[model samples]
Target: MKNSITPSVPARGPADHEVRDQIVAAATEHFSRYGYEKTTVSDLAKAIGFSKAYIYKFFESKQAIGEMICANCLQEIEREVRTAVAEADLPPEKLRRVFKVFTEASLKLFFRDRKLYDIAASAATENWQAVQAYEARVRTLLREVLQEGRQSGDFERKTPLDETATAIYLVLRPYLNPLLLQYNRDTTDVAPAQLSSLVLRSLSP
Candidate 1:
């Protein structure tokens, strides 16, 4: 298969490493219930029935655990987008379908792990490094996609592709805003597909 723009994070070990996953699951719960600010190693260890020092053996701090949780969530989004783009089967339309693919993935990411999303948002609002890196990667991906669209005459925006992409990101950002998720809480109003369609059609020639 051809190389794709999927996000990959540092791998720890195997799928059968039950103990590591137990920590991750415990961290996920703690981060969800208490959020980044309030979640502590002792709390996570207590939740998992592990020792505080044992938690340290796997993760040095809450921030490190937060990174693993957020990284796992982001990785899921990347996999979905990669599958959509890879299976579109038409290079000409691959560029256009990427929007749908990415949007679909975003919806899944949003709904599949609201708790982790909340934790990530709390960290992001605090200006965490992993969140900043994810944001930059998002912008970079948008810039590249927009540039491709321009080259193929799919979009007519005259500004530099990166600037244009940034503008578009600003416009469509609220749909994925974590605050909105807090309000909706039930996932009834956020329609990532419709949002993606609106964006894709807006740029269609």
Candidate 2:
């Protein structure tokens, strides 16, 4: 008989945490200036004054680092959406606010930091965990809004809750998706309000 043992990985120490943050911060600046697709791990290493092997010790690949950045950006948008919805007095108003704040927040990102937007676009295209989780949270929010409307006698209860939420999410997908949003920018100014109105009308009790 032979005995086998697994090698245990060491826990990260304070210095390790500091180095990881340094790598991520430098990578963010590098990616912002150079674009995600254009920049390489070697480039980040050179810019951060670190060896490529050292960088890899913290992140298995460039995409892993990118995932963290993308998640942070999406979290920002989600926070804005939540805040806007929270300030509303009614389900109808909350739903409208979701459209307005979400579109505005996304556009702000796209226009303000296009390099970062490129990473988000890539995340959306690849169905990254961050994007997928964002979309799930959004759908859940929509369902909650619809439920509130029904309970308040503001929305029709005939439609299935999940179906209605899915439909609303689909309606807003063009504006929400980074890739689609670029092409849809021409209509961005007025589309969200108009679409929300149309959806709200359909939901009337």
Candidate 3:
């Protein structure tokens, strides 16, 4: 039998980060239109005028690309949340506005672009570091709000800050979580304002 040799893959260079970003952007567009399950490395490469081999040089798999996209989306959400937190004065007001901003953004992003949301939700289950970091940032923001509320005599101090933040997250999860929001929309008739009021009441001093 004749011996066969595998061709060498291109080495990553200083430009790899830029190229990787380009690949991620193209992947985002394709995933948005066709969805994560349907979008493939081939589609991404073709869209970017590159080859599948080149894409593999930067990303190990399509899932990796999806993870990057999810991270980007979460980072965007975090920025919006931080802005909402900075602008509000009182803890209750901060909590309410933060919750409103997050829920509104979630609904707009998930419903308008469900495919990307689905990919993000799936990536979250795998506990990607980006997702974990984004989650931590949210928790910290919530804890800060709670601490401020306690100091200002706005929120009851019976519960620990961590516990209060956790409770608030859980209570509003159906609205914050993409999958849960989808389920809630399909299964129930409760409105976002109603849910907001219920959560705010629990935080009262």
Candidate 2 stretches with Cα past 4 Å from truth are 1-18
Model 2 scores worst on lDDT over the 10 consecutive residues at: 1-10
Q: Between which residue pairs do clashes occur in model 3? A: none
Winner by lDDT: 2
- Return the TM-score for candidate 1, rounded to 2 decimals: 0.67
lDDT by residue (66-176, candidate 2, tens digit) is 877777677778788888887888999999998988899999986688887878888989988767777887888899889989999999999899999999999999989
lDDT of 1 by residue, 89-137 (tens): 4333554454555555556676665566676576556665555666566
- Taking the tens digit of each residue's C-alpha lDDT, what string does model 3 give over 10-97? 2244444788888888888888888888777887788779999988888788877777777777766666777876787777777877
Computed on alpha carbons, the lDDT of every model, listed in order, comes to 0.62, 0.83, 0.72
Give me candidate 2's TM-score against the actual structure: 0.88
Error of 3 at 115 (Å): 3.1
Q: Rank the candidates by TM-score, best first.
A: 2, 3, 1
Residue 146 lDDT, candidate 1, scale 0-100: 67
Candidate 1's displacement at residue 85, Å, is 3.2
The TM-scores, one per candidate, come to 0.67, 0.88, 0.81
Candidate 2 residue-pair clash tally: 0
